[model samples]
Target: MKWLWMTGLVCALFASVQAQPQPLPAEVQKRIDAIFDGVVDRWIVQMDRWWHDGQHEHLINMTYFAIMLDPHNISLYENAGWLLWSSDRDDEAVALYQRGLRNNPDVYDMYYELGQYYYIRKRDYAKAREYLEQAIKFPCEWFVWNTLGHVYARLGEREKAVETWQELLRRFPMMPVDQMEAVRKNIRDTMTRDTTPTAGENTQQ
Candidate 1:
């Protein structure tokens, strides 16, 4: 039964892509895509149940199945990558994110996820910086800038860190009041530390 269901899904997707010898009307194409999205969403809900039940193997298998059905689902990639990383399958997690990047070259979230993996898991500050830089080149959420600032601070680039948080404030004036205040505090604290002379410097003076 599972194989039949899988085969049906594959056939449907193959037909949608390959059988379209002539261009489909934009509306028709959109509706078809929406139908497939609905199907994928149902499967994802089942995967969530498997996740909560501690069925790790089933969850992993269903994750791959879901990705096969909808390679463009960024959340699926993110969840799967994080799951593998948390399971101590570090290499697999990296490979999954890399595959997501290949499929979603323009996606900022993929780059951000890779940056986070390096930052939190490997403590490879330089590698994290590389990916975070790429993430900022595209449209992204404010956390991208926030994380980049933290990464710069980790690398001992205090000036860059301050500049990054400042840029975030400049670009997102309408950010929530609490978040704005937090960022302001970050900038102030960084600048204060930047200017305050170290004990060695005070002794030299």
Candidate 2:
């Protein structure tokens, strides 16, 4: 449970480094490493630390070390990004997901995360579609289709959303009974709602 959470946070940290310059000077690098090494050394001891806990300061600072290790490390990129996102650095978050996507597209749960970035954070439906499409290709157990349906709806393609949900129902028949019914209702309701907005009504008359 917490394992994924912690691991994800670490990965984002790697991505945050992308927005900044490369490795620090020899003296600075050693100091930063020592600081992070101390915090990492305490992960076992301070797993329950609150967000405001002092241990987190160094933890955040230590992210640079993860980035310094290997540019192609997917986990580190993800961890760096999560940390940066937590600190309200969303652009940096998107940058990390993209950078990670470059080296290996199958790194962790990146596709879903990138879709979220484009969908909610960046407000770019086209880019959202791109990431969500990549996510659906993976064998993830996350909210890919449901979110993709919502993305289609946001793009004013209600029919696309309805059909997408239907497609999901066809492919994943074991969907929860309530959710299955909900999907059917959503399709029907979306169809009904779409019918009422006539071509004339949508015009600038």
Best by TM-score: 1
TM-score of 1: 0.80
lDDT of 2 by residue, 41-75 (tens): 45534432522474544544444344444445455
- Model 2: CA > 4 A from native: 1-59, 63-83, 195-205
Task: State the weakest 10-residue window (summed lDDT) of model 2.
Answer: 196-205
List, residue by residue over 106-161, the lDDT tens digit for candidate 1. Answer: 97989999999998788788999999999999999888998888788777788998
Runs in model 1 lying further than 4 Å from the true structure: 1-35, 194-205
Best by lDDT: 1
Q: After superposition, how far is residue 182 of candidate 2 from its true place, in Å?
A: 3.2
